[model samples]
Target: MRCEAAPSATSPPAEPAAVFTQFVVKLYSRCNFGCPDCYVYEHRDRGWAAQPLVMSPAVMRRLSGRIAEHLRSHRPERAQVILHGGEPLLAGPPVLERFARRLRADCQGLTTRVDLLVQTNASRLDRAFLETFRRYGITVGVSLDGTAESHDRRRPDRAGRGTHAEVARALTLLRAPRYRPLYGGLLCVVDLEADPVETYEALLAHEPPAVDLLLPHATWHFPPPRPPDGGEAPYGRWLAALFDRWFDAPRRETALRLFDSLLDLYLGGTSTSEMWGPYGSDVVVIQPSGLIEYNDVLKTVSAEAARSALHIGAHNFDRAAADPGFAAERAGLAGLCAQCRSCPVVDICGGGLRAHRHSPDNGFDNPSCYCADLSFLIGHVRERLTHGVSMLRARFVQGRWSA
Candidate 1:
């Protein structure tokens, strides 16, 4: 019933103090699969090549201390530590087990509860990995790009062959009754060429609990497949189509993070993700070398975009958070451009993701290259939500739920 009009232009929320709660730990910096569009290996930043192949025990100890230090200060009820990498499973289960164990031990007795999850390509997933993950109460999140055909197009092996078979095989295990609870979600990047409905249905086939439909990371320097200031807001049209399919489904097949976040915000509820709403940015990542830096995704923008002078061994995460570079991230609405701030949907779009606002001319102060698309998508959702609620109320005489 509480609906904020989706502004005609881009916008996000006002800046509240940023408290870091989510952390990513790169167990290994090397991967078995060769995804051509991979932000880490193929993006603007080539720093991954020089990074340690896997996190050493010494680095792990320091990372634990740094994360623990942050937890002691923020005292968030629960903290999420996602294990990632070129392909974290490349490091083997034993190494993962050791990393999880160390993190738990280091943060012991802290008010914050550390929950661990591993995000993987799922090409190398097997009983060995699942068993180890299970023992530590670690959850498993696989990156399967919808159907086999669609998935193969974006994610292939180094040898130029599709990895759909192996990924599909791994998903079976993760979807099994014994492991389904650990099935964090399916992650599908928006592919404009693919049929939106087909792509969504393919993901539904997995029976995942949730789905993360990410925009292919791009900046002004390098635009997405369908650029803005033109006739079609292709990405927006695609999502709007998918949103209708999801919103009208008689039964909820999966919880989509993007759509869910939008819906929650429309209903006067706070967001669970920085992807939307006016939520303060509070995510961080630790590379295998124990460097506490900004979100690793920023590497796609530039080499130095995500780097920081802060190292876990030398500084607590608090100091790292205070670093000028990282502070720019915590800027919230203030971080957005004048055009975005004046946009009607500012609260919903959040000036697009921070990374998407990049341009050499204006630095990180420009509207996202997806500005047209975000405007289209957010505006469409707001209209549908308002109309749907109005219709539902019209159908009910009392305008209230009754058993």
Candidate 2:
């Protein structure tokens, strides 16, 4: 594959390098499970309804070849490919098998690592699926909320019954010694009403390697329900409690990405995802139709799915990286708020996730939707550490004086 410099002169400086790390290929727009809160279907956009049920083989081939050529030029070896969708498992064995094999074959000589990952609801995770995952060294992330009651409320089947029991059974099969290594972790959406302890306990029973807690999506236009006047909403409170419990828990078993990002910000680091800061450069998503898009959130911005085309074929990665609009959006992370710019802890906070920062009117240049919750949690964590440091210093002084 031949490589060419970006035609646009608005390329970023060389030192920081491109952070284009992951590409989520929407393999299908159809899913077997029906979660009441799914953004793809439940949101007002209704775009997924129009997308083809599955990615065409021609588009997939073009995407795979294009990505390989892009990697050859850009050489960001850590770039990953996630088989995303209504449910990636909906592609079944033959499709996934071909996709993975072709992806691996296309970029054989490049130093970059192309990880094949599947984000599934675990409904169709039978022996065949597990076998495919193992064969390709694919990491499988299953979406399961907490206990039956909490999980059932939001994540249900098309028939209106809770899918918790069925998902759990599938997960158990995945962990049944034979397929344990292929399992990545559990992806759970936060339910504000459920007790944090109870939810945590329920999830811990399953022993997934990691747990990702996702906040529900809403906007100023469609703001999440708030009290009549005075009382605070339960969403932030629930997350705060979970953070507290995770901190106080006897053993740390699960890898919570949200908490990890928060901790990174609190400790003065930028987040890996656009959600945490103004990071605009390092990410990209490949749709089933062979187009390159920024975070999938941009789908809400335009009805023409083809709006984000930087370089459509297999070789546009670096060119997209050099886009002026992309750079401006990324730099916008730091200017999120006056408070964030001057805040003592802005490095770690990164002004929160881009999705939360997005206001239809303001683009992605605003404060987080969970600004209150984030500020509250960061304050609490800071205080705990500061007090601990003071106590240790006092003890040291006392010992020296006594001696």
Candidate 1 per-residue lDDT, tens place, 1-403, comes to 1124653546665333346788989889888788877888888998888889999999998888778877887688988999999899999988999988888888889998888989998999998988888888888888887777878888988887899899888998888888877788888888876888999998888888989888888999988877454367888998999999999999888899899988888777877766786554778889999888898778879999999988888887777777877778878788789998998889888887888889999898898888889889988998998898888787795545552
lDDT of 2 by residue, 223-327 (tens): 555546524535556777787777777778787777776667666675654445445445577666665666665443344422454545544666676665455
Q: Clash totals for all models, in order?
A: 5, 11
**Best-matching candidate per TM-score:** 1
RMSD of each: 7.2, 3.8
Candidate 2 stretches with Cα past 4 Å from truth are 1-19, 227-233, 268-270, 299-311, 323-325, 332-339, 388-403
lDDT top scorer: 1
Looking at model 1, which ten-residue stretch has the lowest summed lDDT? 1-10
